[model samples]
Target: MKLKNILIVVNDIELAKKFYHDLFGLEVLLDSDGNVIMTEGLVLQDEKIWCEFVNKDIVHKNNSIELYFEEKDIEAFVEKLEKLYPKVEYVNHLMTYSWGQKVVRFYDLDGNLIEVRTPL
Candidate 1:
């Protein structure tokens, strides 16, 4: 089977929608009352409904998983992010590894870890 999409449970659909679109330019491919599918195979679901379906309480602020993205122009992307979210918390500011890849890590509005890295 082919991998399709990654679904994330979000507290506020509208807030998450705005955050993803503004930050990553992920266009909405499909949208309903509780779910939204974005361009890059990302699906955002309402936490309440997700919890109901999973039969467990939704956890927040955990660092166990991260949504990763790669950018060709990582420097420009980082500059734009810094300007847009001046006060946003960062897991790590822009850094280059010995392997010659640059990466930045930060939390989304719902406290999900997100990393943007250069292609290796």
Candidate 2:
């Protein structure tokens, strides 16, 4: 089966929406109480509801996984990100890998790891 979407558990839906929209320019496809679906198959769900549904405690800052996005112009994207969010935590600041693709990593508002990279 083809992959569908990624659901992120968020502490606040409005805050997540603003962050994703302002930074990545994702448009809201659907918005309701405690849930929002944005462009590119990104879904934000309330953490309390998520935890209740999954029967597990909400965990933050788990750095084991990352949401990755490919950018056409990584440098330009980095410039915009830096200008808009100067205090964002960066795991790696604009580095080229051995494969020749440039990438930058950072944490989201809720400490989820996100990476943007240029195609090799």
Q: List the global CA lDDT of all models.
A: 0.90, 0.89
How many pairs collide in each candidate, listed in order? 0, 0
What is the TM-score of candidate 2? 0.90
| Alpha-carbon runs more than 4 Å astray in model 1 | none
lDDT of 2 by residue, 1-120 (tens): 997789998998998898888878999999988888899999999998899899998778789889998998989988988887888898899999888989999998888899998976
Best-matching candidate per lDDT: 1
Compute each candidate's TM-score over C-alphas: 0.91, 0.90
**Which residue pairs clash in candidate 2?**
none
Per-residue error for 15 in candidate 2, Å, reads 1.6
Name the lDDT of candidate 2: 0.89
70: Cα error in model 1, Å: 0.7
